[model samples]
Target: MENFNTDLDIAIIGGGAAGFFAAINIAEQNPNLTIAILERGKTGLQKVKISGGGRCNVTHAEFIPSELVTNYPRGEKELLGPFHTFMTGDTIAWFEERGIELKIEEDGRMFPVSNSSQTIIDCFINEAKKHHVKVLYNHSVKSISTEAYGFTLKTNQEDIFCKKLIIATGSNPKIWNLLSDLGHTIVAPVPSLFTFDIKDERIKDIPGVVAKDVEVKVLETDLESEGPLLVTHVGMSAPAILKLSAFGAVELARLDYNFKIAINFICHDGEQCMDALKTIKQDFAKKTVSNSTQFNLPKRLWKKLVIASNINETERWADLNKNQLEALVDQLTNAVFKVTGKSTFKEEFVTAGGIDLKEINFKTFESKRIPNLYFAGEVINVDAVTGGFNFQNAWTSAYIVSQSINS
Candidate 1:
């Protein structure tokens, strides 16, 4: 730090998605911005290697900024302007221009047509190399000090000075601590995307059963979500649970990940369901209750719900009594599952908190608290539900940082 040789003109901390993206874009646009990505690991872009089951979900198919911003539980308001600047469409085009083709899944998630995460990693690496963005690996940042010129970063390898600094380290507490020491506020991190852990007779042994459309509500809370729900070995997953998990990250964490969720298996009102059941009883009087799966629900899950409603497997629809009908209606409309805990996907774990959004100037993604201090990616308090949304945030924020740098 004494020499203050200014090792880089633009120094990016973290070699993950946002870090590499910002560095490459800035270097390519400016052509003379001496940029380097100080990655703490021996290798970079490891998350890119394993995301989307190794296929690398690049960005979601959402084309509108307003709709796209809805996916993020935090930073929804702040990112609206940034997404307008650079978002899903721009992300798709950016990769397309680099000769990578992306395909959209039925669920709106976009991935490399090559079906390999390596494709994305290669593109970023090649782009960085072509733009002369030096990627310094194994340079774990220990501390950061703001200097008159720019900033001083003390890493495991060396202390480097830069004219401008961009922090894109995603959900790294140590970096957050460093930022805090530099007078930035950090929102306490909480698990975002996760699955509820439930052990119930209704859902047990019904793993792999998927209800096409269902409504899930956290009991006693305003938290609710609607989408396809999948019954896993432990409990429930898919977009329905993931959305609730993201939106209720803070509330659920405050609940200690222990709460109860009411699931509407049929996505129908209790009265309508009861009336439908009456019609179904008359229409399928001879049919076994458990065998005749209703509401397009998977057979296994239907049977479990039927049995949980006190309807035996051998009972026919005609034999169902008034109490049995009411019970069945309740089970279908408001089945409650006690969520004892949560399970996070190790490779795709997302945090709901980071640098407070108010502290950042979204117009330029620069720090209002500190001059020339930029922020991007999950390093900020913005996080989204599963899909390709988290990656889109990385791309959008990184792109904005690059644009801000050159402008």
Candidate 2:
């Protein structure tokens, strides 16, 4: 085993988004302090390279601290002050100052004007080099131990000592186990931000059909969300299901990923939907019930629902009986589907658990139990729904840690 005799002033474990952000800011704040980033991967920023399908959703366009913090399910309360200090606006200015201009999409997801994740990777790499931050790739951390003067970090290649340590490892169970040994409570990790899997005649073979602005509620639970709903080959995706997946991550996990969900394709109440259906029946009495798509839903989905309600393709609206009308109304208003499993959403494999938020001080993102030890990003029990909010958390927490270190 080899040991590095020279000790660094700051050592950051994990070279992902939070790790690099912290290293760059800390080095920029204290140029005289020697800092090093130990990353296990042969190349760092892999997630950044693939984020947002290579465009790298940098952050959200949300500027207000209170409104912005609501996107985070776990750290909403603790992050209020930290977000007020450094948030989406600060993140934009930080990148803009570095020659990267971010553009906000219609959905509020901010990405570089170049529309390439490589741009973000390049900026981080260049900033680290310009700030004189040492990025040690392929140096996997073996263990972390507190010493008299500072902390000792044992890696596969060498043993490094630092006066301060930062753990930016995102959702890595091994790192959480190490922190558990260091007297920090580790929340049991569970998969979040997943698409529900369903096998129903309604959504089957309609992978690209999307119903905009629908409401979905998990049956027997209080979990519900509203937004776009997309039909995928396996089941369902899009904002509505994704939001429910995130908010009910723990509960759904407790149910073993098998549950039922009711979807309001029209986003209307039962009576209102029935009234609307009756009006449609009168307006299109001569037209075939299956042929006339109402509620602005996709024709294919409407046909499926019509058929499910016992109305045939040749059944005209005028021939539809009261029973059929009620069935159609029920199917439209409270359609239930069984979710047998879940699938990851693109490259954003987010988890709901991490280092318990109560153990860390949001002011500096420093450990309350262990002084000089800090955390940022998913290593702590903080995660947000889809959009660039997760990256925003990384930037805000990392920037604050840098500021606190300088103070």
Candidate 3:
């Protein structure tokens, strides 16, 4: 490892999204001040490179700060103040100013027009280089200490001192420990943005089937989401399930990672499902019950629905009794799956807990107790549902901290 003793105006621990962004922003704003990003891994921006299955879901296109912030299960309340300063619009503008244009999908996920995460990685790398930000890979910070003048960081490579320190190490426990040891309170980290593994025959064969708008509810909790739902080989995924996983992350972890999830395959407001079922019975009276679904559910899913509803697949829709029709409506509208366990959503996973939000000043993302000590990104107790909300959190927090550091 290379060793250096040069003093820096700011030393950012972790070269992830928030760290690099903060470094670039600070260096660009204050060119005379030296900034360094110390990363533990062999390569910086590992998460950014792998996010969105390599395309990098940069940020959601939601312009309304209040609406966009609701996606965050952990940091929604604390992020309100920060989003007012730098929201999704600011994130897009920041990237656009660097020559990277972002495109918004129908689902509101924003990705680079290049359709490559490398576009984002290259942008950050080039910006950091342009600003002369020192990026030290494989230099893991072991601890940090505060002094009257500034802060001191002990890393595997060498010891360094800086006037300001930003903790952007993300959701790693080791990083959390270093901060906690530095007198920062850390909320225990728990897995977020995962999928529920349900071993039910209804969805067993149709692994890749997706529902555009489905609702998922945790059996005994108020956690719920309405969005796209994907049926995976192991279980269920997609935006809705992923969002549900985030909201129930801490509670699910406490339950030893085992819980039951109820899924309403179709989201009907009130008695619409019953009315639809009656219409289906009347319109498709000659068709087989299994062949007469009201909506565009997959064929295999229709079969499963018939089986789960105890209606014979070959039975004509006209032969369906009142009880059978009600059961079918219930199956379509309030399908409940038994979620036995959980698995990580590799594309966009985050931790639910981190530095307690109460301890940090949301307006600046600065530690209320520790002067000049700031926290951003996943390092703090803030995580959002997939679709660029997580990246937005990183951006908003980093932007706020940058302003605070300059102020």
lDDT against the true structure, per candidate, is: 0.91, 0.91, 0.84
Clashing pairs in 2: none
Clashes of each: 0, 0, 0
- Candidate 3, TM-score vs. the true structure? 0.95
Candidate 3 clashes between residue pairs 3 or more apart in a chain or in different chains: none
- Model 3, 261: alpha-carbon shift in Å? 3.0
Q: Each prediction's Cα RMSD?
A: 2.0, 1.5, 1.7
Q: Which segments of model 1 are wrong by more than 4 Å? A: 1-6
Question: What's the best-to-worst order under lDDT?
Answer: 1, 2, 3
Clashing pairs in 1: none
Cα lDDT tens digits, model 2, 115-198, are: 999999999999999998988888888889999878998888888999999999898998999899999999999998999899
Q: Please, what is the TM-score per model?
A: 0.98, 0.98, 0.95
lDDT by residue (158-269, candidate 1, tens digit) is 8899989999889999999999988889999999999989999888877898898999999999999999998899988999999999999999999999999999988889
Better of 2 and 3 by lDDT: 2
